[model samples]
Target: MQKNSFLTLSVAVLLVFSLQVSAQDAQPEAGVTPSSPFHIFDRFGDWARLNLLTFNQVRKAEIKAEIAEERLAELKAVVLEGASEDVVNQAESLSTAVAEEVETDVSRLDEEGRNIADLTDKFNQLSLRHQAVIEEILEKAPAESREALTKALEVSKRGLEKAGEVVLKQVEKGNLEKERAEKIAERTIEQLKKQVENRSEALKKITEELGEAPPELQERFNAKLQLLEKELVNVESNEQFKDLRERIREDLKATVEDAREFRKMHNVEDEDSDDILESISEDGAKVVERVEKILSKAKEKVAELERSVAQAQTNGKEIPARVSSLLDAAQKHLTEAVAAFEAKNFGRAYGQATSALQNAKNGNKFFEDEDSDEERDENVLEKIEEANKKIAEAERKVEEFKSKGGEVPAEALRVIEEAKKQVVLAKEALAKSDFALALRHAEFAKKVVEKIGALLERARKAVNSGTSNTLRVETKTEVKNEEVERPANTASSAARQPQVRQVKITAEGFLPRELEVKKGDTVVWTNATAKPSWPASAMLPTHDVYPEKGGCIASAFDACKGLAEGESFKVQFNPIGAWKYHD
Candidate 1:
């Protein structure tokens, strides 16, 4: 009886131990359903999804490929247009390489399907190439060149939409699937293991860093964990899982931040810490697509404006003065802008040209408004023009007459007489208010007078024929023997003889025309005559001398400094005799 009781106790103990193990295996207490907040891990169930995680990389590569193709096309255009062969070839080679790289990226998707790092690196390199192509095209093409830009923009936008679609697909591929119902179960088991390990690690780290945890925090955490384990097999509420994830993540982040802050406060030296520069570049194709859309819109607007302006101009039956002026201004601005652009005064030129274009458009719009009376007095205009032309001709004739000597030929006088007769008749008509007849007669009369005067002047100048012989005079007390010996046949009509150094000199209308002298003789002269001794000219003999266009004497009046034209310039010669002098 004693042996049997002892065996029964051992067996019962073994059965209880087995039952506990079975229950533990049956429920992990952290099993999350698809509807649970921690259901994000459901997609990670498949071995293929877990291992082949290069979708991010693939998305990035697709963008790069799109950009590369865009560049290759641009390069091809340049090459076709007679660009440097080497550059074209280089572009081709690069395109080929990029193509291969893209192919390699796609090929390796099976091996590294969700690798974000590979995608990022490869995408970066490809993106650079893509950007290079776009920049090259943009740089070569003027900003106003819309066609190329439009096409490029369109390509970019399409690429972006496509890339977004690809990325969405990639994210979907990383999620829970219909075929993997057991994934949730496996994740729950893994999460439990992770939580235990993390808890142990945190406790150790907290102890080392903070020296100790407050008693209250430890007790509360322990209670929460116990309660969480009570509903092991079944999830009681969705918030429970959500709260658990949040509380754990938040606690960890806060702990790390607190430790760092504490170290700083205590002046602890932690050298391993660094300021990490994180660069998260978007996919190239997507960026291109967005930019292209903007560029395309701009292009369309510009085109529409151009077309509208052209149509407006074409529709104008007759351009108004104000509108024409505005157009002219616009053209000038455009021309200036083009010149500026050529000279590389890029900013100023662009502003001027754009302003000019806008002004032109405004002018065109104004011209489109029709409000002009297309009526004119054609006969009146003709008569007025004819009268004006006759008057102009008369003025020209008068000028010609003045240019010659004041004389009129007989033929010209007769012609003038006839014109006067006609003028008299016209005046009679004008008295009766016959404006057209009066104007016609007046024009004839004016022309006749002008022609007569011109003819008279020409005849006078022809008749005079004054001698061209230039004469210069020199005077001295000691006369030259050669001058005395000179033939007295100066002119048959008028002759002058030197009366043995006895010349009674007197200045009339002006002082003697002498600039310098040192004669050893005292002489006296008076204002003896009103007329000038020499025949200067018929037009202005006494008032002024030469044709100095703008009026003024280069030298001041000689009264203060020396003497005026009417005054005696006293120069008492001291010793030697100075002969030649000029005014």
Candidate 2:
């Protein structure tokens, strides 16, 4: 009986509403048309009539919602039209108010014993979609408009959060269960994730394109790259997102592609018409002849190293197994080079010979000194101080590079860290009263710092329109750092300091075999070895002592991991003395 009464009430209310709408549409002064009337009645008329006592309240709510929505649309258009800050802020405020009003009305309708939960959900969906459109616009906005666009995005995010809260409150009020509320919240989270993914893709693409950027654009390019890397690193390090790796695959791929492009542009060589190091050397024939000479020198050096190895064995010295392995590799490559030469493949022979020579020289460093001299070097403290100063200068330059928004190379950072480690080791040696080892470590650290400084200087130059087109390959030639004289009181004298000097190492030994430099000048040693090579002071086998009392055995320097082929180390000289070093 009650159900029949409810159906009759619903029918009567709909008939009356339809009559009123038609009467208004027929009168031109009423400014109401049948098609222009509130469509709210089409969906909610039955529900409103079920409880007719609140009919007036429902009608007012509907009218208010219609006004709010219209206002919202107008404001949205103003923002989309690229309005001024004041207008944009007004639009955002209006949108927020309208969203809040619609939500409040839905809650009121539910409170009035009306069944309108589904209506509330529909409105929320529309609100979310509106925000999506705003977000899309922000993504395409120009850099100059980023601040405004970002502000708009934040507003939308906050609005969505408010909507989620409303849903949760409804759950508390028994209008929704906890499970349903959770599902709605999950929907919002998914939307947020998609937005973040889109942003990540855009950033990665920017970083990739930055690979071929001109020098003038490097600062801006690096700024974007730095921002992307920092954000991606944060995402990667988040424990909560660990399981979402698959979702972040696109972001990760972007990072990888950026790195690959950088290496491709900087390190990886393209094949030339003539295969024998055409990009590295001028004349193929000259390169081949040089390699042949290097191979012959390696043969003699290896013989000397073998004899030392035998003596060390006889004397029961503690020999690192690495020495023997390097020897074997050296001999193998030399044999290969000989075979290539015999077959008239000069290019192949040259490459093989170069590799063999590097290996042989590296193997020889271990056997340089069979016993350490018990000498106390008085200059250890001086060398340590000099090294610290150089490292400080290098660190300052690195900071400057970062401040200018330069893309600091990972290798450059690694080199600085290595220098710091060497400093620690040097201090430990000093504490042990091993002056020779201390001095050597201090020297190595200084060299590494000089290299880092040189690299950062080059980066700074790039920001000022310098180009870095050539690969930093290890060469078997000594290039002195270019020094220019300036007035002693010039404020920018440091900026005009000489470029870093370079020293190349192969199987024969350090190219030039001797280096001369003024105090504070730096020299870089590049290893073109096929095998790993450790560079230390002229003390090995029994490195407990030095040949001269002035040399500290505790100050020894060696790259903990012997340098690989094409790798390099740099050192700054500050001591005024004749320092003798060998391979």
Candidate 3:
């Protein structure tokens, strides 16, 4: 009996140990929380699962989308739980990894001649859900966790954009039925319209909360609201909706800037004041780094301009005195920026850097010889055609207005006459082979034609409302012939133009490991690998070995995010030197 008891006891001990090991290894379907000790094991489990599906690309893509959803859930959980910044960052990183994997898998599946219409549609819906969830999380997240959550939100946005692109490509390829594509486009437009409406409502609330803003602030808000109203009127196609979305995004950024100014002006303080201050401090450091990078690029541009001037002189072309003066001014500003940056005066450094960049751009304009190039001639011709089209459209709109019993304002008629005159001048300049002058006149004509259309649109609205018969045309100064005269560059300066260099990233690593490129040349890194890879400046994790700064991390040379298969990232090499980087 004692022997039997001993055997039973041993078995019991073995069972207990087995249970313990299983408990340690087991992970939830949605993955472990960031604070869990088994988090690493959960990640390892994900990797192992993905490896098992290597032969089934579609299945892999589906699994990846599910995994991305899990990561996104974890992100929301951490934010809602008021997790520490480190935990939030970890969650964000996890979400980013899975999202990138999904992106790469979709790309690979498409490249393999497989039908990915359904898969891309799935991803698109998933991304939209993720974006909504992230926006909700943003509202409730702690201030300290906002930055990480914001990054996670960006990842979701990128995923959404990529999936949308793929879906559109599938539609273009006729992989999806016409009805289904139309449905997809309609759904996308509806979603964007909802977002625009939400933003407008939020802005209205902000205005109400502020009670009384300065006249200029109120004017700015009104301008944005009016622009949004205009954008909302005619967005029927995917392309038009895309344009509207970008415009809304830009307006959102402007709104944020306006809010900051309002806060500073009123010395606003709230529960989040301390957090805002801390965030601003961090952003200030980034700003300083960005300014320093800008100065560095400005210096390189000035050097390039100098070389161009020397080349022009060598070719027996007269080097303009104003170009040299601008270059000198740029150099002086760069020096001042460097000193300000060293002194940790970020505001002054930013101003100096901006001035330096502007001066360099002005100097570089002297080297733009559009008249000497056939391609430029074509561009001018296109501009003239565009202007003529606008004038025709405006004339048609005026007739439509008059047919509706609306009277055209005298100013509107005058503007149309001026547009015709400008078009005539543009044609004359084109015949003379003065492409720059031709382009200038064409642009002015287009602008005048647009104004006339706007005037007619207002008049049509008034007539519809039975408010008035005459169009309201804003009084502005007309363009003069003398104001259009600008200096043109010689043909030799075109030789100094910047070129693009391609670098491929394969499974082995960056192809050609080392490369020689001139200052101002842009290098595009394309990923040909099966997996996602990040191309960053030397020193690994920190990525601070490069002289330039202001990337997502420590150096401007960094791609900042993983490039999926068939994806690409580009950066201009401004500071001439032997730079080291890795994937």
lDDT of all the models against the reference? 0.37, 0.50, 0.59
Error of 1 at 393 (Å): 33
Better of 1 and 2 by lDDT: 2
Q: What lDDT tens digits, residue by residue, belong to model 2 across residues 246-308?
A: 454454545534533532443332122122222112332343454455557667776777787
Better of 1 and 2 by TM-score: 2
Q: Per-residue CA lDDT of candidate 1, range 1-583, in tens?
A: 9999996775555444323432331111112222234323322322122234335555546544543453455454543243454544444444445455564554466345553333433333343333234433532343234234434433332232222222322334653232231223223323333443344445454343333432322432332222112112111112213334333444333333433443343333232110100000212123223222323333343444456556756987444455556556666756655564454333224334444644555554443434332212233334445545554565566557657533333345445444545555554544443344445555555544445444555454433432111111212222244444332223631344322221122431224433232122333332234422221212232124223332233211111232333444332333222222212
Model 2 has an lDDT value of 0.50
Query: Which run of 10 residues does model 2 get worst, by summed lDDT?
Result: 25-34
TM-score of 3: 0.35
Model 3, runs deviating above 4 Å: 1-31, 199-206, 211-583
CA displacement after TM-score superposition, residue 108 of candidate 3 (Å): 3.3
Best by TM-score: 3
For model 3, residues 134-166, the per-residue Cα lDDT tens digits are 666664565566656666655665565566556
lDDT of residue 509 for candidate 1: 24
Per-candidate TM equals: 0.17, 0.26, 0.35
